[model samples]
Target: MDKIKIRGLEIWAKHGVFPEENVLGQKFVISADLYTNTRSAGKSDDLTQSIHYGEVCQFMKTFMEEHTYQLIETVAEKLAEELLLVFEHLQGIRLEIAKPWAPVGLPLDTVSVEISRFWHRAYLALGSNLGDKEAYLRQGIQGLQDRKDCRVTAVSSFLRTAPYGGVAQDDFLNACLELDTLLTPEELLDVMHEIEQEAGRERLIHWGPRTLDLDIIFYDDIVYDTPELHIPHIDMQNRDFVLNPLAELCPAYRHPLLKKTVEELKNALTEPEEAHAK
Candidate 1:
């Protein structure tokens, strides 16, 4: 990634804990590092291929002047989100907000807050076995798309498959969804839980019948294992239901730990074990 740096851009804004500070306002210094691939812009010398720092500065100044917040932390968080949303070409950003004038009587140089934010790609598997399974899956996808922090990039055709956990239940309609999201793995899980709950999902049995089921299959080629969640979904390689749909959308997406593409995994699952021994 190439960098376009904006350094020490000053602004007058009303952001402070004290009422008087808000009334009188103060000066803030903002610095940002915009990350993007500048290869096309560099070769073609096309302004359209690159983000204009001047426009960004004006946007920041107007945004600061228009909004009043008590804490710089809030300003940084909200502003970073706004910038990412507005600038489609930016891959990520490091933003800093500095307040030079302190209310404290004691001498101080400045206080500042800095944060880094970026979009992450993640894969999810959706399943439902209860009433109107297709409707539940569609609802789940819409719920994810509605979030400002999440973007649904692709969805595979739903598959009708029998239950895997030996539970005597109706066959499930399953599918895979790809997303570009700003939420961490845990945050994404929480969003999924909210969607499932909205569809009346219950947790009486492991792999039991449900109104909706959402699982995090992969997150940016990351191999993550935690107490609550597992990336590449534990045992997904052996599940034809998961691998088949995944292969449809991302046949070449490699599993970080297994180092095998989705197409390869799906083929391995269908191949006879005797062939593997030979």
Candidate 2:
């Protein structure tokens, strides 16, 4: 919500497509806008409460000088990742890498590449219905945690639920997890698929029994849908298994499409069953 700007910091780094450019370094002007909450730091007058811009500058300089890349785009991309990783206080960053020395024979001052990268909050629904279902679910969480680009922030207590989709299978262990990740939606899906494969999950049957099932329930209140994936997880409001776990971890987390909080959805789904039993 607050901004700390670092502009026009110059550095010399070896990064270019040409062989000679790699051998001979060039001047690169780096700029970054670090985003975070600085209110506590400002009020307390404590350096520990906020990000240190001076340290960030030194880190940028050292990182650029150490790594060699073929394109300024690569430099910006990799540098953004590095900065976000190094500074735990930084939630997002806008980075620019400018190459002033152009090999072009024409008159040109410089060329640059800029990128905006941030840690995205994502909610994941995890389920398993095969042998050692709890083990599969735990393994899936560990796999996500192992990735450098992903951080598991919170986890809901696991719930036992009857299988959905009319599949004749064992009871499922279901839960929701909160994560902070730098990966894009598709990239995160790929990671989930990898975990599923590791758990020996098969996709032969649609909505059928599986060793593990991981679905992206939410990504920063974003409404996204593609042929391969859908955000708000298509009819999640109707599934008690999904909502119950979500309510445990984040009852206030609202569904962007449904416009209902997790607690509301969970209550709406359960109230009718409760009345029926009464």
Which candidate has the highest lDDT of all? 1
TM-scores for the candidates: 0.95, 0.98
Clashing pairs in 2: none
Once fitted onto the true fold, the runs of candidate 1 whose alpha carbons sit more than 4 angstroms away are 273-278
Q: Which lDDT tens digits does candidate 2 get at residues 1-278?
A: 89899999999989999988888898999888999999999999999989999999999999988989998899999999988998979999999888888687788888889899999999999999999999999999999999999999999999999989887878999999999999999999999999999999999988798999999999988888899999979978988999998998899988887788999999999999999999
The CA lDDT of each predicted structure is: 0.93, 0.92
Residue 140 displacement in candidate 2 (angstroms): 0.2
Candidate 2 — what's its lDDT? 0.92
Tens digit per residue, CA lDDT, model 1, 1-278:
79899999999999999998788899999999999989999999998899988999999999999999999999999999899889878889999999999687889999999999998999999999999999999999999999999999999999999999898999999999999998999999999999999999999999899999999999997888899999979989989899999999999999998999999999988788758778
The superposed Cα distance between candidate 1 and the true structure at residue 117, in angstroms, equals 0.1
Which model scores highest in TM-score?
2
